[model samples]
Target: MFGAHLDGVSAGPGINDNGSGSATLLENALVLAQRNPTMTKRVRFAWWTDEEQGLNGSDFYVRSLSATQKSYIKGYYNFDMVASTNGGYFINRITSTTAAPLKAYWDSLNLQPEENVEGQGRSDDYSFQQAGIPTSGYAMGAGARKTTAQATKWGGTANSSYDPCYHRACDTTSNINATGLNRSADGVAYAIWNLAVAATPVPDDFSMAVSPASGSVQQGQSTTTTVSTAITNGSAQSVALSATGAPSGVTVTFTPASVQSGQSSTATLSVGSTATPGTYQITIVGTGVVTRTTTYTLTVTGTGGCNGGQLIVNGGFENGTSPWTGTTGAIGSPAGQTPHSGTRFAWLSGNGSSSTETLNQTVTIPAGCTSVTLRYWLHIDTAETTQVTQYDKFTVKVNNTVLTTLSNLNAAAGYVERSLNLGSYAGQQITLTFTGTEDYSLQTSFVLDDVTIQAG
Candidate 1:
């Protein structure tokens, strides 16, 4: 494959064989200029000649260069017989330190691992490598037209060789084939750039944590919550965090003055002196799609020096509230038209016309009680053809503050079983004020059963 002879019997100009690589390099360089390649480290590209002449051209090029010029290069890549009908790349790392960046780059991309074989650096890289520089290169398969498999896969002749009329008397322009050229070009380009950018392709790893996975306390007594996260390789990253849905009288703030990526920092969540006690869902969202949430229980002790267990209005009375407000619409009960039992309570809304009536009642916890719970039934009651003017909703207030307002008297059914933090009302009387949203528009009375008072 030396200098090509037009009619053979002499050296032939192997333009297509290696000229392709040289031409490609020049074109690619121009393209790089257009691309505005930015590099904080360094950038280098080279074209080698006399590769068929025992790499003499590359050797002279390396020998003539100054030590500084040679030292500037960390690795070398030789392109020899890059377009041969059948030829393979080889590496030489004895004198030259191998360029490990390329291998690391390939590994990070999750690409297939390279198979180890001998015969490397049998090209221009040998000259630079002899002076101590890492090297790598590529090669083509033995002389043959496009492969049958290659043709099918890449739309090229399968049984034919890429360089059909390889280094022979017939090795003319006709021998050169463009089959799979685009694919080959693309593959090389992708690999080079992929390696080039692998330096900073991936961001650092991060982690977060919330202490006291779950906690419970009587309202009024402050509880300290801790926030923390781990930074594995976040050497230079910013981590910001914020929270919502926390109970009143509670203050949450991140420390180290700022929330950023790095080390375990301390952040304190302070439940204030006047916090309403209840099981609240607090969400803490981190930067860049990281999220975590915690459920905290703030139990408020009620008057009467008693704390009742959890309850559900229509959940079959696990914890009974007899005589307090039994939901049984039995004898003498003149509320909702629907048949009522202990397990089924009347949902109070204003939907009661003259025929339909809602059950309404109020309870007060003595000054000794810290909190109270009134569990009932609720649902979205959509007006049917019979009742057109939908009117039913209720507001609940503890002393003065409206804890929860219910418009849940709709067509769909929903269970109501919730707790309020009552630490603030300890020794202070609390009255649950239930006011009808509308005056008998639906039901004149709001019937809520299973009223339990947890008095301290």
Candidate 2:
């Protein structure tokens, strides 16, 4: 799906804020209709209204979808302010599969696009994201000032707001950057063509292969390869893609997750810092009417030494609670409490009533390590006035064995570092857990962040 807001603010003409995006979408739709190419997947174009009123239009559309209906949508692409006089090329959710085609289109033009941090959670795409649908888009930038690096790359004045007339009366057709608009429009078409239409007509059957079938990566690094498909015998059909046989400390993800036969997708292999160094075969399976398989050889080179081996995955809670499981709202970046380091942390037992919240992840301590240590930063805050009462309690445990315990009595103003020597548990798989238990009166919050299990 491709979408843009049709409504604008009450300020000026609001041409540059969204006129550029809407015009681009219309032009692409016209061209696509004229060409009338054979499409493997359905393409949707949405021009939403009331976007200025807190994304009400897009939010309502998403809220109206059933689970099965939502699942049918492969991805969503949004275009908001794609043409600013001093704007720089930016891609929303740049790391996602939905952004792959847009990024590739920009990269082909040597545009050196950046992630659109300034517009995140401030646009219509946020609506689709909340519905768990993959979304990505383009932007020329908005109220943010262009930095010197951006100016040098995209050729604009440094420290100037990308859109000086944003949401203002002066925003009109004259404010649109023709060059930026042209590039953004072309990128939108490029993504749509790559995602929906096939390059060449073929039969119903499809053939699959991976480009650069073998690659090498170092620990703590990542690499990507393209998975291509071509129609062989039958008509185009959806091919669901998945990867398996990855070793521990390694993760495999596909951008589109699934694609119509004859469309290609990007497969990314991320190697954790502590991944065992070796060669491995990763199988990419595409299941459509029939299952087709391809293999990619991955060689993992070690970074060397124990200091480079951190066993914990997403210990800092930066990756949104993957590999760790517990309560629904246990891990997040809530407004009241700040994390020890990153924007997210494990927050437990702030409910103020009788409650228990637990967060845990399982990892193996490598056999040959001479020393192993666990470290985390903790911040405790409480509404309890009494200093001596241990009303709310927090505990750290390894393999269900208590390592240490603290209470509201230990509450302090800021974060404190806690460390434990785990040499005794070396060469064993263990579950590290943090549990918070609150009593019936005052609320005590136990926040943990920047966790790591290092072995030497």
Candidate 3:
């Protein structure tokens, strides 16, 4: 490809025309050979001795190959005139799909390149493409004037030949641009790495686990829980999640409805106050290439109607003081006041003096009862308007030991209902007491209504 002294012409150096391609190709082959690369496909390099004389060596080599031997080639790429002086980046406008990697290298540099105008069918790759093999190549321009558009895209003097001494005697070491040679060498190396490497596809698969999978909810409250997802036997993927078979008035929501593989997310299950009382089984499913399901149990309690259903005697006080014993203060059923439920409710009043009033009830614990629940609606109003400390107070007790305290300072807005788990005293007879005490100056009233006790 260099100085072979062609017929009827003086012997001269051809370093800028085909010499740059031959040298770059040889360097690439030598580097790969030095590394002893373990490649998926075999890479073969050819140096055509007479490309200057109309591609005689490459044409003879292709004609000698059998059809089976030719079919082994997936693609053919040529590099010619790659380091011309004042080189303008150029890529072959290939008619086949093998041009993607060649185009990608220029695109990654954000460089706008022109097509291979000077070295189209005039190189050794033309023989491969004529045999229906996919072809792609790279070339720095040769003997062509750089237009104004090329100057704007590649930043060079316009209307001047890319290589002023192409195919001349002086096209020697001085004819090469060091920066262009380095960039063109890097591009050729990238093409070899992109095309000769084997790729393995990843399979999509995952699993899910909901921690504390079983839980309880009050008839009208919400709960938040966590679920974790893990990718199994695959690369990262997005998994869509959903819930099925939830009870009435119970809504389930996932914070991130979709999650990346091998990562965990949270799902909040909100049970409305009017939700039906029962045990519900909900299945949470995550869908991707494969579907996975996890089951969660939700138990709802305290739907009222406990007198004939085996627990409370007068929960709503509709029977009017039949089962409760009042002691030590003015405590009675008040009429025409706001009640949480039913017409009458019990009220304990401390009219402007420090006094304590209490209501007691003795309930026999049913045998084999593993858990007990106490729920009631409460209201407190007081004239004690102080921030640092509380004066008028109300409390609940079991056997005269304080269980929980309530006051005007901490009471819910407008008689909200609350629940208590008395599972520790499941098999013992217990005295449940509701007490209210007022300080010396301000009068505060404590009201209780719509109470229920259940054993399960």
Global lDDT for candidate 1?
0.44
Query: What order do you get sorting by TM-score, best first?
Result: 2, 3, 1
- Give lDDT for model 3: 0.69
lDDT of 2 by residue, 107-222 (tens): 87778899999999988999999999999998888889999999999888899999888888888777877777777767776678778876564445688999989877778999
Greater-TM-score candidate between 1 and 2: 2
Find the 10 residues in a row with the least total lDDT in model 2: 7-16
lDDT string for model 1 (1-456, tens) is: 001111111222222333223344324433553443533334455566666577777788779978887777755654333343332221223222342433332233322223223335445666776876556543343354444544554344566654455555776544433322222333344335434533332345466666764455444444555566565442435666666766677665666534565444444556655655445566655563343333434343322333333322333332333332422342133343332345444444434553332222344333444444454443344343234443555565666578775542334443345455655654444555444454433343344444444333
Q: List model 3 lDDT by residue over 1-456, tens digit each.
A: 111112112222222232222344334444554453445677776666687788888778778989998888887777777667767888776434676766665666665666787777888778877877777777777888888988887777789888777777878766776555555555555566657743443356677888879777766667766777886654667888899999778998998888886777777888787766556788988887878888877766543421111355777777758678876233344453577777777787647797877888888655444457788888877777776577888898989889888776864447878788776775678888899888888877788887776665
Q: What is the TM-score of each candidate against the true structure?
A: 0.33, 0.40, 0.37
The positional error of residue 430 in candidate 1, measured at the CA in angstroms, is: 23
**Every candidate's lDDT:** 0.44, 0.82, 0.69
TM value for model 1: 0.33
Clashes of each: 69, 11, 1
- All predictions: root-mean-square deviation over Cα? 18.6, 23.1, 21.2
**Ten-residue stretch with the least lDDT total in model 3:** 1-10
